[model samples]
Target: MSEIIKIDSIDNNGRGVARRDGKAIFVDGAILNETVEANIYQKKDSFEVATATRIIKESSARVTPRCPNYGVCGGCSMQHIDPSTQVAVKQRTLEDNLWHIGKVEKAKVLPPIHGPYWGYRYRARLSVRYVRKKNDVLVGFREKKGRFVVEMDTCPVLAKRVSDLIPSLRACLNNLSCREDIPQIEVAVGEETVVLALRHMVPLSDEDTQKLLDFAKKHDIVWWTQSKGLDTLKPLLTNSSDSHKLYYDIPQFGLRMFYEPSDFTQVNPFINRTLIHRALNLLEIESSDRVADLFCGLGNFTLPLATMAKEVMGFEGSETLTERAMQGAKIHGLENKVSFTTLNLFDVDKEWLENLGFFDKMLLDPPRDGAFAVCKALTEMNPSLRPKRIVYVSCNPSTLARDVDVLVNSGSYKLLSAGVINMFPHTAHVESIAAFDLVC
Candidate 1:
């Protein structure tokens, strides 16, 4: 029998750690400062896997999860813990990763960026399955450890408007001729509009199309259909030009960016705005300075930076996204100040860096893979062209820490400040921003 130990604290991954017989046992559904009886499932030499069987003593941070399937649905992990505590845990996780893994400490820890805990998720990919045995269609996120879709009538994390339409969507799909053919639905909610991207393995009949159109008209939602790859996505009806765009206005910068449903966008628009404001503040660009916005998706930061800088050069891997960014700049009449180029950032070279010319300030918002090659290339560039200041927006803590190490130890950049952004409230995903300044 595996001995149970009191969980001392929560780890970066949201698991609670307890020591039993000199071995670290990780228990799920256990909170910090709580005594829980856990049942060990997997026993390893140095570590063990366990699930909380009973809560002997509860932590003050523990709260009743809003969703009945909170523990079973993989969509959220920290819902059982208070929202305030969730943010605190994430902030500490960011600091611990930076200090222990990166071997570098930030000069300052900025206050964490947080927003509405519930009804905050504006984007989600919901799995769809038709369970004939249950005489119903299962939609929403998958069950925590199970492959079966959670029979969710509504999702609390989804925007209130979108959450209310979940049942209607399920009913509409359930009645379609090719109900079983539909595998998933992608939800993208913007300031004024909501788009649903239906991924179908088979073609929809005329009746099915009309049913979808009727549903769209009834709910005042936009319907987009994807038969295959991303490029194959198209509107179900011909008069959806206005409905297809997801719009958000950045009043602070006097800018608005429109995007398609399938495009990459911040799930939480509120926090996104906050993050952009913070990054711009950290850059503290002078009117004479030129900035480079690497991995600039649809000019999310590039256009805002352009308003303050003399010139802003944006680089992205997708030609489609680059063209969209260019269009956005033109729409906002900032094209004169903003320029964009399409290049694979993962394999950036010294030649590419030199071709881009000199930049005083840099903003890198790379994906989870991190911008190792881009950072390395910048470090190897001619001294005259190397950016003096850099702001890195990262979605993964470990990679951020690793890249921070490279910048601090080898690239002669001093860590300025680092902090977490609670973009996804209930999940373990961590979004962080760090600033670095070149040391003369």
Candidate 2:
């Protein structure tokens, strides 16, 4: 039976929310204020999952998805709505997470940091599958609800140069000697360089190497082959005259950042640049202030902070990343102004934090798990040792809410301002930043 339901709101995952029989019903593809005939597919104790069979009422914000494979491919969601409305949904998700999860009543909502929505994805791990039944090779993201690779000719979310190469990439792999042995491709795009790291289970035959070289020459893109692990990733033509490096440029800071293709970097370079600028502006670092950048991956934020602060210390869990961060600082002529250290940020306590000396300001760019230990330490440490202000960059809202709760409810801290960043515009990924000021 087709049950009619009205969407009360939208969730961060772009799902429509409604109430039925005293339980929350999350309807996929349904938007706010729209009534739809939904089918409940999965049931939980308090909530249920559904899909819209038909729209009794449609929202004006609905727009045709730009990508032909939008619904089938898992690369993007929310393409059914206008790009402007997509960001609005993200902002609402951030605020909702703060209130419902953190239990804080209100906060100053900062203007969202957003940029070019289309062709914005600069880095992606695409899946490769050789289907024996179909006698065809597929390349791109996986299916929305299955592990099978989606059939796609081009991807709109990738940089134009990278998107245009999907068909060619598939064709090249299909004719390879060990076509079935290849399982994945890592794509990285810099300001002027494009690196495609092909993960193959077997060694490439000489003919396969020549084919890859020809493909690289024809496309002006470099190739890296991996046999077992990321450690095995290396350029196909290491000694060739081609001397390009994979790096992105931040003209705002006059910094050219370099990284390995397998290293973690923001997928959307435009929004990343905007996010860094907005984060630093919100940090309000002064010349005399000593700042610490927590989870500083390759000095993306530390070097920029060094340019403004008297001294900056960056801490990361990976020695490789810390070494790269130090090199970046040295090459940028900010070695004297900044330093990088390797430490397990997750295991830190109040005393450990206190041992690091006083930091006038602090910035955190943690992974999806959020900075639990650091926030807890701030609440437990001497108020004199706590930084006066903090600016946190988070990719997950639930963890951010959980950590924010620890800081505001237990810690002597005031939630000053918080807002969302449209880092992944079409998808439900919420990249947000929050500010806190220690209570005097």
Candidate 3:
């Protein structure tokens, strides 16, 4: 059955939202204000999910999707809309999350930060599958509707080198004796090299290892293999040097950040640089000020803070990340000005925060869970002990709002400003930054 509905808004998942007889319906492939004929796929008590089969009236913002696998692949959702409009939807999503979830409003709104429209993704986890029925291997993102890998040759949003390697990669892996046992491939493109970590469930034969090495050499790429877990991910060849190491540079800060294949790094390099710059500007770090960077992954923000502040203390849950952060500081000759502590930030309380002493300013770059425990602790700690200013970099709007709620409503902090960062364009991933200042 088909129903013609007018889209009212775009949901957090980038689906077009419509109302029919007081019930909400979410339509895929439909844009706001567009009248579309949709086929209902999933139905719940309060809302129904549908896929737009025909557009009766099209939105001006809608554009022809570039990728052939646009609707089929699960990698991106908003490619049908214009790029600028994509950023706008994301910005509105951030604002709505703040108002509805946090029950607070920002005193100011920062302009959305964005970069290139395509070929910006520097990291990806491509799925691998060997189908006995087809007698061939499939490599790419999962299909939108199921666990099957997308039958795609290239991904436009991914880094060009890595995107171009897809076809050859599949052919090379399919030739391997253990192709059926290979499950996934991690793509990490750095300024100097492209690293691919192949995770296999079984051991690779000598022929398979030689084939990977030959492929790496032919493509001028490095191959890392994982037999079981992250601990097993290492260079396929033991003789590889620092030149083969994966790293990206922040030319603005004169810093180079290095990480392993399994570590987390922003997929978009351009916006990551600008976001860091915008965050530091909001921090207003003085030469005499001492700063704290919570959940600082590999000192992405902490080292930059050190460049402007008297001293900076970094904290993370994993000791390995903290160790990497310190090494990065030392490489930049910032060892004297920065320190790191490893503790589970999720488990912190008021007493623990108070013991850390007073910091003139603080930066929180937490994961999707947001800095809830830390924000709660800030509210309970002595007013004098709390930082005067804070800059939060978040990837999830809902959790950011939840943590920001504790900071603004429960704590003495005021929501100074907040805005979205189009870090992952054409996708529903909403990256945002917010600022706060002590009010009491």
lDDT of each: 0.88, 0.90, 0.91
Q: How accurate is candidate 2 locally (lDDT)?
A: 0.90
Where does the lowest 10-residue lDDT sum fall in candidate 2? 240-249
Clashing pairs in 2: none
Predicted candidate 3, C-alpha RMSD: 1.1
Candidate 1 worst ten-residue window by lDDT? 236-245
Selected candidate, larger TM-score, 1 vs 2: 1
Across 136-214, the per-residue lDDT of candidate 3 in tens digits comes to 8889999999999998888999999988888899899889999899889989999989999899998889999999999
Instruction: Report the number of the highest-TM-score candidate.
Output: 3
Q: Model 1: residues >4 Å from true position, as ranges? A: 1-3
What is the Cα root-mean-square deviation between model 1 and the actual structure? Answer: 1.3
Clashes of each: 1, 0, 0
- Decide which is better by lDDT, 2 or 3: 3
Give the distance in Å from residue 352's predicted Cα in candidate 3 to where it truly belongs: 1.2
lDDT score, candidate 2, position 86:
88
Give candidate 3's whole-model lDDT. Answer: 0.91
Pairs in steric clash, model 1: 72-144
